[model samples]
Target: MSENKGNAFDFKLFKRLMSFTRPYRGIFIFVAFAAIVMSGLAVLRPFLLKLAIDDSIVPKDSEGFMTYVILMLVVLILEVVFQFAFIFYTNWLGQSVIRDMRQKLFRLMTSFKMQYFDKSAVGRLTTRAVNDVETISSIFSEGLFMIISDLLKMLVIAGFMLTQSWRLSLIVFIVLPFIMYATRVFQKAMKVAFEDVRNQVANLNSFVQERITGMKIVQIFTREKTEYERFQEINKKHRKAWIRTVWYNSIFFPIAEMAGAIATGLVVWYGGLNVIGGGAVTLGIITAFIQYAEMLFRPLRQIADKFNTLQMGMVAANRVFGILDTRSHIEDNGTINYTNTKGEIEFVDVHFGYLEGEEVIKGISFKANPGDTVAIVGATGAGKSTIINLLNRFYEINSGTIKIDNIDIKEYTLASLTSQIAVVLQDVFLFADTIYNNITLNNPNITEDDVIAAAKEIGVHKFIESLPGGYNYNVKERGSMLSSGQRQLISFLRAYVSKPSILVLDEATSSVDTYSEELIQTATDKITKDRTSIVIAHRLATIKKADKIIVMDAGKIVEEGTHHELLENEKGFYRNLYEVQFADGGNP
Candidate 1:
């Protein structure tokens, strides 16, 4: 995030990236071999031109001329073949690396704690996975090949020039140091410029994503014009960044051209004098030297261009590495008795916070028996959801201990803890897949009968059956194809299918209509009959049948009793919430 950071290309990071390609080392080696062959063949063309000029054209030898012409044709044919092989192998390597990186990143992102997602933007993370990976692919396929071929060509051409005419080669080499210095400066400038471009593009992408996702809010508030102006501002900044990048590149390339031209002009002037003075410089040798001068410039120019691309790739690499570098706030130790868990959950003097010095759950304490239904009721942001999040170990407690079956929760593997717990959140997020797939996401091998039974238990089977595609109905992105109540029903089915020992329902019935809510409540009662349940609800009426109810206010438990006992306390927060709901016509 810092603008003044040094070059984003870290050698250690590249070394780590290369490890992923180790599995396909054979392919990469073959790609490099082909590139070397192609570059070698490319250098042969200039030598053939020199041979034709000195042996055939100069001496008027038709037979020799025909032979040299045939040799040139053969070299061209081999060059084409090697070029094909080079492209094919590098393409294979690039795609394979892309696939490998995507898998690793996807696994890491999914395994990261919820807290990471809470602090990061979805759009930025998505860009790293998709756009950053693509930049790497381009580097491997095109940039890598250019670097190898150009360097090889430069070396071969320099050796040939020295062998033919060391004096002219010396003259051309005089400018080499200056060119290198200029290139180094340009590379540094381009690195900073490209990093700026990448950051600006990411900012623009984030803006677009946020606006699109919140389009409904913008329209409802009649702020479309304001949002458009905001987008224009971001767009203008992106454009300026791109223009600056282009301006730097434009100046760098032309300056490189001028340097090369100066070197060639000096070579031509000096070579003519050597030939005129009857020195060892032949017309063919001088011609080859000129060709070598032109060839030398090519590699320098290519190195410059490759550096620009490498800078962009490094910027992308920095973003991706930043994500991979983040240590998860919560990770389970590989110690757990998953095969036999009694499901006794307890929060003993737990203290927690989302930020330092600001506690969200202050000294909360509770114990749930193996089959108790404990409902937590509170106003929004009163730490109701925070309690359930802690129960699932999505966050680590600042103090005290959360124990499962008398063992600290941290002693259990995260997978073990999460697998034994099912949560139906307030906002259901269904993937763009079939309804059957969404419900069976945790247990893909679940039988069709089990799927139908889980849906029936959540009172969603009838609605699914009514769909034209039945259980195969597509949910679309975020369940946009279904109503809010139907999406909640599907989420309920998903949780029910898992049959977790601990079921946490956070506003699970808030979106459901009265008829569906009644059916789901009845089904929930039956399902939790022998399982521990923790329900967080704003609707006080929904948890009236709970075995125990805890009322929370300002991150502290203020009341604890059965539903009737809490209702009997006229001065309690729970009683006040109940009265307010009843006064609102008992709808909740």
Candidate 2:
């Protein structure tokens, strides 16, 4: 995320934001009408008072005075009603707009290429989707429509003052230029200040989110004290940014209040002179002008404040739209809707890289015939995982043809292709949800009976039933409550239930204890039977029975044959790797 420069307010950006209101135009128009009515109500009160004082009170008509007071009270009650309507509907507008925006943003993120997630920090993305989206909500709840209402009310007040006495109105106008000048200065300063404030807020959010999520790492490394110092520095930046806005506010408001006071004082002094001089300006007009001047200048003061809020919203919108504007998602232009496959897979001259000019999978080629179990053995960073990512179209290849059933994988719709293949990642992720939901992913078609039967087939039914809630048990965030083996069992069961024709297990048995490994091995054997299975394993013993073994080094296939055939070659890459693991007392 780049720091936001305190540039001029973007009306084009603002106009784009206002388009979200189209969905709630009924409420929008209602709020607009309410602002007009409220402004009229505000203007009417002063007019009624002038009439009450000059006509009813001075003429000594008690009945007329009471009638005028009753009318003012009625207007006051109506004003309160309209104000309530305005506030409630405006807030509704804000909430609705944000809800829609949040959904759109999340949907966009869901389609982004895996490479995008690889490069983006989890904390930064969270800040954009959560904090920035929330800030934009203020445009409706506090910024845009509210500012419009205030401006409308201010204009109405000015009009009423002029009708009362043009000369007195001119006197009041003299103070406005100073107020306007101050407001202009305040507006520019606050725009930049708010940009800084919002940026700091995102940084603070990102820092805090990362720190909390990685607390275990901090504790294990004994870096808590160092991290705390770092947090304090970031926290200080956030505080300093906010304090600047508060400082600007303090300076601007007092100046506005003083200016309003001076305007009223001028109207009072000048009006008093006219009344004493027996001129046209009356005491009734003077009293009304005082109220009118405050009404006029109060919104002028708030306009500056509200404009800063608008600036904050614009800054947030700019960040969020940055994400929406990215075209990094995998291209899914394939029109073929293939839901089933014979599972014959081929990779021809495939090349890929996470970064430009740094190919991680270099012109690799391999094939897995239907019902064949092919094992890929490689050291870390040998691009074993990158192969599976490309096969699933999580990232596009730099140059390659990946085919299933002799049709380019890109010739199949992403869903049609992915639905036919299920990947069990090395680092399995489970949502904070029930075991059943995690396994079924809330798919309406995958029933509890289906999960249970599949779990039984995988020899993990008893394992699940032994838990306190059995399949209904809740796995707290990221399946933290479950052991590594247990989570693997759940992941295997999830893939089993999906019934994908092509199954890829990426280091499924690498990180678990012996008992867990045995359970996963049993489940893997059961699921891979008659399915096109691609298994990447660290243990040579796991892939011994695989029909073919492709040994990779530095992203290239250096040895290709069965386990026994590769072992027969004394100097082959697989033979050497196997001997090294055996020498290290590792599974071989």
Q: Rate the local accuracy (lDDT) of all candidates.
A: 0.83, 0.91
Q: For residues 1-588, what per-residue lDDT tens digits would candidate 2 score against the true structure?
A: 334354557776778888888999999999999999999999989889998999999899899999999999999999999999999999899999999999999999999999899888888899889988999998898999889999999888888777778999999999999999998888888878887887788788888888898889999999999999999999999999999999999999999999999999999999999999999998789999999999999899888888887888888998898898899888889999977668999999999998899999999999999999999998898989889999999998999899998999998999889998999987989999999999999999999999999999989999999998999999999999899889999999999999998999999998999999999999999999999999999888899989999999999999899999999999998988889889967645
**Reference-based TM-score, model 1:** 0.94
Count of backbone collisions in candidate 1: 0
Residues 281-382, candidate 1: write the lDDT tens digits.
888877887788988987898888887777777678777777777788576674874543567888888899989999999998888888889999988889
Best by the lDDT measure: 2
Q: Which regions of candidate 2 fall more than 4 Å away from where they truly are?
A: 1-7, 584-588
- Model 1, residue 484: C-alpha shift (Å): 1.2
- Candidates in order, TM-scores: namely 0.94, 0.98
User: Which residue pairs of candidate 1 clash?
Assistant: none
- Residue 468, candidate 1: Cα error in Å is 2.3
